[model samples]
Target: MIKFLLIVNRQGQLRLRKYFEEKVVTHGEQREIIRQCLSAVDKQNFLVEFKDFTVVYKKYGNLYFIAGITSNENELAVLELMHHMVETLDKYFDRVSEIDILYSLDRVHMVIDEMVVNGYILETSQPRILVPLQLLDVARK
Candidate 1:
């Protein structure tokens, strides 16, 4: 499975680190899906590779983290949508002090955890729970 760990800094820059498993398990157009997913984020390309379809990162910066099990056959739209959502969140949360966000509640999906000290933003450390894209759409129903 392919795992993506995306992080955001106080500078509003996004960094994505892909976890390559070194053994391709889900094969048959994996790159194509990734391409489309990148496009959905308004990005032309992604620095991603796979091995066994697994990508693991212990952590990143003082702001974010995620973990997921993705197969070659996983829907492109889903991956793209998730990434898009992450981008959107980063844009709006300019002054977040801390947040614990889960990518998906359905399976053993990704987790995004951040800690923004008052020194970083202000004397305000309001915690928030950012919902997964799937759930964000669901409650609107």
Candidate 2:
């Protein structure tokens, strides 16, 4: 199961964080991890093994979309999920960017929730994930 997800920018600033399990971590610890992630030389290395968890990340433009999971989890599946998430966002916002995400954080959060429920991955279908968002958008009008 996935533990947490973190989206950070090129400057090592965290853009979004979602914790599936209850884990109390200090700001300093998170900052240290961000520092290491930002300083990584091999951008192609998608999996980074930490002490307690493994991180799977993909660099998208200036943002790094990451998933933190246990050692026993499926690395490839998580990586695919991350890519699917980016593609879903791109379709929703006509090419997603940091500015677009910041402007429509609610939509992003909704999409995330649709894709993952209680830390477990749901469906990979774009239409399945966007159903809620589409319904909400229709209702708002």
Candidate 3:
């Protein structure tokens, strides 16, 4: 199960953070986790083990999509999940970038929420995942 997802840049600036677990993590601990992930970005392995969880991360342009999952989770599957997310974002934004995520923060969150719920993947079909957002756009017109 996924415990949290973090979007951080090369400079250690956090863009988005979503926690799925019921436990509360303090801001300090969250910062430390980001720091650890940033430090491990240059490592050869994409999977990094922490005290209680494992981090699976992938880099897209200047942004890094990092997922903190249980030790028993499949790392490769998480990587694929990240790729799907990037592809979805790219399709939605016509070339997704850090700036796009920064500006459309809420929409980005919505997209992730569409893909995952309570730490588990709810949907993998991009078209199905996008339908609700499209409906929302049509409603606003």
Candidate 4:
């Protein structure tokens, strides 16, 4: 099972975070995790083992998509999930960037929520996943 997903910039600023489990982490622990993630990605490592979880991360421009999963989870599948997420965002934002994500965080979270629920992938089809968001856009206009 996946524990959490984090989007962090190169400078170690967190752009987004979503926790699938109900575990509570202290602020210091959260910061330490982010630091470890930054270092892991900087070394060009795709997978890193933590205390009780494994981190799978991919770099896109200056942003890093990181997923923390149980030790038994498949790293490649999580990697593909991150790639699909980036692709979906690219399609929606027309060349997605950090700024785009910062500005439309709600939409971004909605997209992530549509794809994942309770640490499990709910949908892989981008069009089907985006339909509700598109409808929301139309309604807002």
* Candidate achieving the largest lDDT: 4
Candidate 4 lDDT (Cα, whole model)? 0.87
Superposed Cα deviation of residue 43, candidate 3 (Å): 4.4
Give the Å shift of residue 67 in candidate 3: 0.7
Residue 75 Cα positional deviation in candidate 3, in Å, after optimal superposition: 1.0
Q: Give me the overall lDDT of model 2.
A: 0.85
Give the worst 10-residue stretch by lDDT in candidate 2. 23-32
| Per-candidate TM-score against the hidden true structure | 0.27, 0.93, 0.91, 0.93
Candidate 3 whole-model C-alpha lDDT, 0 to 1: 0.86
Candidate 3 off by > 4 Å: 41-43
> Which of the two, 1 or 2, has more lDDT?
2
| Model 4 Cα lDDT, one tens digit per residue, 24-65 | 455677777778877763565788776788878888999989
Question: Alpha-carbon error at 73 in model 3, in Å?
Answer: 1.3
Candidate topping TM-score:
2
Q: What is the C-alpha RMSD of each candidate to the true structure, in Å?
A: 14.2, 1.2, 1.6, 1.5
| Candidate 2 runs further than 4 Å off | none
Q: Candidate 1 on 1-141: residue-level lDDT in tens?
A: 334434433332333433334433333444443333333343333323344343222222343332334554244433453454344455444432234333322211222222122112111211232344446558769
